[model samples]
Target chain A: MATTLHVTLAGNPNVGKSTLFNSMVSGKSRISNHPGITAESVDGFRDRDKDRLLVTDLPGTYSLHLDLPEAKLCRQHLDQDVEFAMLIIVIDAMGLRRNFQLFSELTQLEIPMAAVVTKSHEAQLRGYQIDLELLEEQLGIPVIGAAERSDVRSLEIDDLIDGARIPAQIPAQGQSIEQWGTDLLAKVSKPVHPEQARRRRLRDDRLDRLLIHPILGLTLFLVAMTLLFGSVFWIAQYPMEWIDALFGKLGVWISSRMDEGALRGLLVDGVIGGVSGTLVFLPQIVTLFFLVSLLEETGYMARAAFVADRWLRPFGLPGQAFVPLLSSHACAIPGILCSRLIPDRRDRLATILVAPFLSCSARLPVYILLVGILFPDRPIAAGAAFIGCYLLGAVAAVGTAGLVRRTLLPGRSLPMVLELPPYRIPSVKEALRIAFDRGMSFLTNAGTVILLICIALWWLSNYPSTPAGAEVTALRESAAMQSDPIEANSLLERARSLELRESAQASYAGRLGRWVEPVLAPVGADWQLSVAVLASFAAREVFVSSLNVMVGVGQDLEDPTSMARIRGSKRDDGSALLPPASAAGLLVFYVLAMQCLPTLAVTRKETGGLRWALLQLTWMTAVAWILGTATRSVMMAMGFSG
Target chain B: MSDFPIEDPQFWIVTLLSISAVILLLWSRNSSKKRDQGGSCGGCKPK
Candidate 1:
């Protein structure tokens, strides 16, 4: 029989539980849903001195009295019928009393657990004295102090593999019994969980002032947000450039080596170019995640949430909704997942309903393209416009949610009572580890999706035959005749004109675009632009690539001239079509549309019905159409011409 | 086929390498603060 020792790494959020888990189990991380919950569970393994130990990294929770899915799962996993040889409770050494609360609960759990005191090096620097033995005796569990350099983890697991049991649970502290259970039980249960006792003594008076004292808390909130922005902007440039260079070099190298053909185009222009364009942003994503993980790990996130509660209440959201909303800024998947924190079904629904408005990173490409084309010299204006769009989306989302609540579904706000976990210095190792993993996932997984889409778009745009092919070939040869002649270049460009060359009549995307043109005509859309908009319904970033392909131009998103050409093109009669008002209208249309397929997939799964997801699509699309038409009319009235 | 944006790819590569070093440095400083403050309560929750 294979003897496997089960060791659980537990701690409050931001206490470096995941880091220690990673240290124990290198390269075996798996994100799995818990046995019966929608929340994600991370599990892994490690080998110590020829013995195998299975490690489970439970979500961060303040106590066993869990209301949130993350906390509930943590508590549920602990009570599981499966036998565990030993439980290793990871405590942020800097947060002794607060960590002790959870430690006390674990003791009451009657599971064999030992305190693995983390951030030991910090204790030395801060001149904090720890009576290790006293802490061990007080909790009736073995206490081990370890920091980044400490490597006794393998040995500790070896001991567990050798059937080591956490010294028996120290009975609960007596002082806290009356508050939780009964005074009668308090007499017999001398020390109710020390955590309860600590919680009683923990002064919310000081924290409450800084956390909820509307004025100061809001200021601190602004400062934190500023720092986050600083990190995202200031720190990410080098890595972004590096990624760009890497992909550009790879594209150039591949294109050079391969014959000039469809395969080469697919590899260089489509795959490398598109994927690298997106993946370059991964460093920024990781940096954002790192800051958030650090804040969350060190316990400031809860306080931030707590502080923002009163302000968020009137908006039909609680303070906790802020984190998920903030997360939505990076991507909607995690934001949607984080909504599980909102216990009230109505609030969660509202959050889900409005979440798409948070301006996801996918929109970044489109935003960048538009900003570059229209506002190239004014980066600040571009950024301000970007922020304005986010604000607009948020405002719209809130208004729509309020409307939905009153008419479609109505419910009262869930009372806000959140645990304020004590602050601890976040483990840097843990932050980096999370940042690395999440960053890698974005690069490898999401990058692949974007890459495949780009390649498909490239293929569609460059495939099959047009009867004008002979004329185009002759033009190409004639252009080559005088390689350096400017007039020859213009003539070759004429060969690529949008003349009623008839070939586009058979191409798949063109046919589909035309088929949908009738439905879009009222909304001021031509078949080519309509196809781009429809493709964008799959993903906002796909808009540029799809449009680029539809126009038979390469995917050079930064090229203003290419966009101008597409914008300047006309119908067979040579009538002007992509007018200023209509172009701005289409831009506004995409701006308001909830057109991401992944978001829809996630919404369906999260809401547990296709009904809500379809409703989301219908409502958002309707909103987009109405708003787009109104905007176009307004712009036209303002003397904008097509 | 377009001319590379930077005058020297290697130079930019080295610059990125150095920037990564700087990031690691900053990350270490932050980690050290957490390490040094380890063990025993200072009466404040880990924020």
Candidate 2:
């Protein structure tokens, strides 16, 4: 067996500790400008010779005191067997005083330490020269200066592995920690050759002044968001149409080749049609995340959070909740996980409870499809509607947060203290990689979970076929007797349509839909729409695919006709299925409903009680239903037509 | 006239296999979720 050695990275928040960790070993720890993003300890490993080196990256903190939860977590993890471990203390070259303060606290542990100073290039540009040799001599430990984007191979970190040992004497023994930190920093840091170009790097730049302005900043943020959502819709349109057309062609080709039977029905409708509904949305997912990644890389997200802090306090939330809320736009799971960054229990739970109200990537297809149906020819209107959906979700989340904080968990949120990371050029390649990874994960899910669902739904809607009703039999007879070819073909088409409709009404899924139709009636959802809604309850992304299956199962998926067929579908009474009122109501419901089972499970675990989860589910459902019904009623009263 | 596909032995065999596969997928997911929750499924498990 090889010998194992453990090394831990410790540092003040935003001191580039996470960047250093990424340099040392390959890890997927989310790198962001937000302080304490490393809410939990993440581990990475490397092997050299016959020995294994394990590195743990702990949450960034200013002090290692036991009272601070982040510090406590670090201590507990370190206490688990620190006898075999060494510490790497990362310091920001530009802010050595506070870094030394944390360093002073860590020396109390009496563990072997190595100091790594990062952002040397940035600091150098600003005229500060950090003397690593002086630091090494003063602290009696291994010390190294590293540049931004340091590669472990070039950093020669392995060269310092053996040199990591207890310092000759720790600082702060003779003086207070703060005073000692100041004195020690003065000795090691000196001003030299400052450049005018880099002077803006130290202080807030002109861009920061405008970005944090109350009016201009908020307006800019909204404009940026609108463009983002607009692009998510418009940019993805071409690929979505291509996927739709491709599936339609495949379905037609398979239908023409295969003999008419259950197998052909299953393959054409269930497999091809079902998967295509989801696959079509891949471009949107990739585009959305890619744009978000690009934006985050530029470090503007922290400033946005800073601007939002003032407005958030009135809603019973701190600016810290903004990161999690923004994360929820991609998925609720990570958003809930990120709530751990909130210090107070009430605030954290409040954030977790309402986080799902933000429309995630899963809801994008549903919004796009409905918006397309609603505003067919106008891209700008569709974009605005897309923004409206996101805005609705945000409004609902914050409103609920206020209500919950006032009633169920009453408490004021902590004051916001945020660090704004320096802006830099965004990396397109890295953004593409993140987007590609997310898109592939979505594709895998569609192939497995969605494929199974589509197959099962097809079976449910296909099985226990009943004999054709009298009307279809009469229509078929009339078709057989017609002499003119065109007239006879038309009669046959009607007969086939009637027969299929009868079959759908009798199938198991149809029966289930009928059972729930009365409850859905208030929202203007008939049995067909009810089936689609129920199918998507556990996995909201399945809404479009399942609706494709439910709305017109056997329609030849031949581009224009199939989509037109769906949009022109009629109810049992021959009225238009999705009138403006019903469509609007359905959108509202989807935005508010707690329709994800996995989210509920996560909520159950995170809150550590079934009661909270149940409350969340019940509260969200009731709010959705009531709001949905009201929207439909109000739209109808205001004279919106089918 | 030939019998329907559902009446054929091959169709039944395929159906059985597909059902088993789905069941296995669900079971594995449940087991893994339990593992993720520290080897005890919360709610019903004793402290």
Candidate 3:
């Protein structure tokens, strides 16, 4: 029979506990639940000599007192009274004091255990002194230092497996161990019980002057945020452009080889043009997520949350909402997933409801397209406008969260009892893996949703034919533009005119747009714009194709000149709607809109009712309509007609 | 009555000055608070 040692891996959040699990068992288990639960129990098998050990990776938690879901799970798992050879408590060496709190409580469980101090390399560099034997004496457990570059601890763990047991009483010579353990607990005494461990580590009064000094700290935070946003946009732009060019060239090359047909059109426009156009933004997404992962891993993000907590409090949200909201910038899927950490149901719900407003990777394409259309000549200006839109999304999210909490789902702010894990230099490998996982998740999970929306939009704008004369004229112009290099303008114009003449009277999408046109007409949206808005309801990115279809651009897999036609298209009376300010408004609208059907579905699934999702849809749509109307009205008043 | 351009140099100078000032003030406040707490609790029994 195999030795079933029920070992639990417990540590503070982001203390390289997951990485250690990966290294130990060579497994990549997501180990999550749908409606969100504490760390779902994960089991891994490891064989040393003849004994096979079963290791369970418990969720990283601050303490074992049954506070959070994961902590409760950990406590419940231990209560089963299954005999464990040893409970291997892993602690970051630099964070020994904080790590010891949990360790001390675990010892109180009176389980046979051994301590493995991690990140010895960092401890050595930081000039932090820790005596392993002394700690062992203090905790009445065998203690060993572990480093990624070393395997001695693995050997120690294996050796201890057979012999490790909770001794009821030790020889009198081990009396010093009890004293040291008592002394360690005495070190953290403070007048106020809660937030003591955190405040002491931060040296609260000093940090508050710089971090929450009302005026100074707030100003610093704002400055830091502006720079963070500006840098993400400016620095990532070069790589983003290279990716765009690469995709564009590949698209052009692929289109050149195929004969005009539906298959060719689907291959070129639907899959490559639609999917890759969105996918080319992966590098930017990866970079942003990578930076976020690093910030989170390093513990500065906790400080940021602490700083923002006061501001966040007004929205009936805890400071813990900040990191999850910030994480949404990469994508809301993970952000919604991370909201599980917020223990309080109401806070988590509010956080999830508002999270999609933090412009995700899905909205990036819509923003880029609008920027390209509106400010073709000013790339830098367009980038700034894009950043501004992100800010708008964040502001809208926070503001709306406040309104919703007050009016609809009134709730109290959750208790803020987060543990601030000591700052450690983020492992590049760990950060990269996290970034890759997130980026790939977008392609796999969210990408499927996007593709379905695209195909549906393609069908919407394609069917219902024009009259024969108009169709012939459209085909001739498309072919002329494709064959001739310079007549692209005429071809594009012909396509646009054809769309204007026939779309509303013909295609299902066009008909739908015209039907809804009256509703949005007061908002200055034409039928074509109305069509785009309707498509955007499927997803924000669908707005581009909806527009492409409205222009009668060869959205058909057979139509090779579709893109060129789209570029040169104009509205009635030869006015371009793709100018900068208009694009900015569109970008703002997409950023603020609850436009993705899949996100709505997921929100409904997460909140367990249509009530929250319905509220989300109504609020986001109302806000988008108001903001878009105001933007267009103001621009028109400034004599800039769309 | 507004700085129209908000020159980059001026922005950086203001940012650095504000940040350093905040840090210094925070350090001082933290030191004082720590002292106050330490003094008050010095003679008290351990929990």
Per candidate, native contacts kept equal 0.00, 0.01, 0.00
TM-score of 2: 0.87
Q: How many backbone clashes does candidate 2 have?
A: 0
lDDT score, candidate 2, position A601: 79
Error of 3 at A126 (Å): 6.1
**Tens digit per residue, CA lDDT, model 1, A437-528:** 76675554434345455655554544343446567678777878876789797776767663223444445556777899887665557777
What TM-score does model 1 achieve against the real structure? 0.70
DockQ-derived CAPRI band for the predicted complex in model 1: incorrect
True contacts kept of 2: 0.01
How would you order the candidates by TM-score, starting with the best?
2, 3, 1
TM-score of each: 0.70, 0.87, 0.70
What is the C-alpha local distance difference test score of each model? 0.59, 0.75, 0.60
Least lDDT summed over 10 consecutive residues: which range in candidate 3 chain A? A30-39
- What is the TM-score (0 to 1) of candidate 3? 0.70
The 10-residue segment with the lowest total lDDT in model 2 chain A: A554-563
lDDT of 3 by residue, A1-642 (tens): 766666666666545554445455644433211112213455677876676677776766767785776678678877777765467777776566667556656766677877667766545544444666666665666766765422332545665555555633322354553464457535422223335444455654465457656667767766665555445566666776676566567667877898754444444555455555456556656776676666665555666666667778887876667756765665564566567678888888999899888887667657766665665546566656766787788789889889878976697886455444445567677568766765775565235544544444444544444543556466665767586655766666566555535533455666787799777754556567777787666556556555654554332222223333345555544566454345545566677888766567657867899998898888888888788767866776787754
